[model samples]
Target: MLLTVSGPPGSGKSTTAAALAEAFDLEHVSGGDIFRELAAERDMTPVEFNELAEEDDQIDRDLDRRLRDVAVERDDVLLESRLAGWLAGDHADLRIWLDAPLDVRCERITDREEKPLDQVIEETRRRESSEAKRYREYYNIHIDNLSIYDLVYNTARWSPEGMLGMLTTAIDSYDPDTDEGKIPVEGVDYDF
Candidate 1:
């Protein structure tokens, strides 16, 4: 059971992924955590490392390659990242995209990073814009397009626990033998 959780900054993806991993007893991996560790190793902030990556595309490629490798080499893993859904692609049993309003996301980030709301908002905008440009140039991917995802949820409307419950229910109800996995179609508005 491989799950990929992809979302923009502060959409509660990491929190939901962590909970799902625990509930399902799967190994949890976060691309952002790995990137942050690498950034710290080089004594640079995430923004600085992202800037460096812009100059050297290998950084992004390497991270994405590692993600792909993990999907191919492992099962019972929950992978979380901005591009996790695309990287995992058909290999994932469940590919979820979480979204929230920009203001809500900014507020979450402000609380999580202990930064001012305005500062967090500006930083998130800059970072997301940079990532979108690099992802387009590097992978020919349009990050804003959610067509590839199996399930899309608006995280702003649910608590982390609520989201987890909904996801677990969906996972539990999946029937692999019948090829009827209760997977939601792209662009469908889910009442949950």
Candidate 2:
């Protein structure tokens, strides 16, 4: 089964995805991390990389398609990405959306980058808007809405243990063949 985790920047998607993958013993891949690695190989800033991603639709689509194909063939896979659920087409057994407040996300960005909170907040906001616009224009994808997900979680209120509890329950209850369960992860925290 394929489990896809997605969210905006600093939404704890990576942490949750990693934890879930470890606990579930699933293969994991993070699209954002992959993009960052690729960018570093090219010595590009996030803005420059995003610009290139915007220009290269086939490259982005192909990467996602290949990843989805792998997920489909694998016994268990966890995909962490901004657009994994959408890109995975019908292969994803569960699509989880992680979310947090703008202020919380800003603080997370500041801490993660070691930048001033205000500066990081502004940059993050700008990045989010730009990515949203670009995704819409390039792939007709609308990520602002949360309804497309099989599950939605607000990490601001739930502790990591709480998240794990919810995920465990969902995994236990979810039927891969029939999507009929609610996975609610609220207020999940990460030590790292």
Query: Judged by TM-score, which candidate is best?
Result: 1
Model 2 residue runs over 4 Å out of place are 56-59, 179-192
TM-score of each: 0.91, 0.85
lDDT of each: 0.85, 0.77
Model 2, range 1-192, lDDT digits (tens) per residue? 788999998898988999999988998988888778777888986656766777766546665666666666776889889877776656677888899999998898788889899887777877787778766775677777666688888998898778878987897777766545534322222111
lDDT of 1 by residue, 49-143 (tens): 88888998888888888988898799999999998887876678888999999999999988888999988888788888889988878777789
Local distance difference test, candidate 1:
0.85
Candidate 1 RMSD to the correct structure: 5.6
- The runs of at least 3 residues in candidate 1 whose Cα sits more than 4 Å from the true structure, single-residue gaps closed, are 178-192
- What local lDDT does model 2 show for residue 33? 83
Q: Clash pairs of candidate 2?
A: 157-187, 158-186, 158-187, 158-188, 159-187, 160-189
RMSD of 2: 6.9
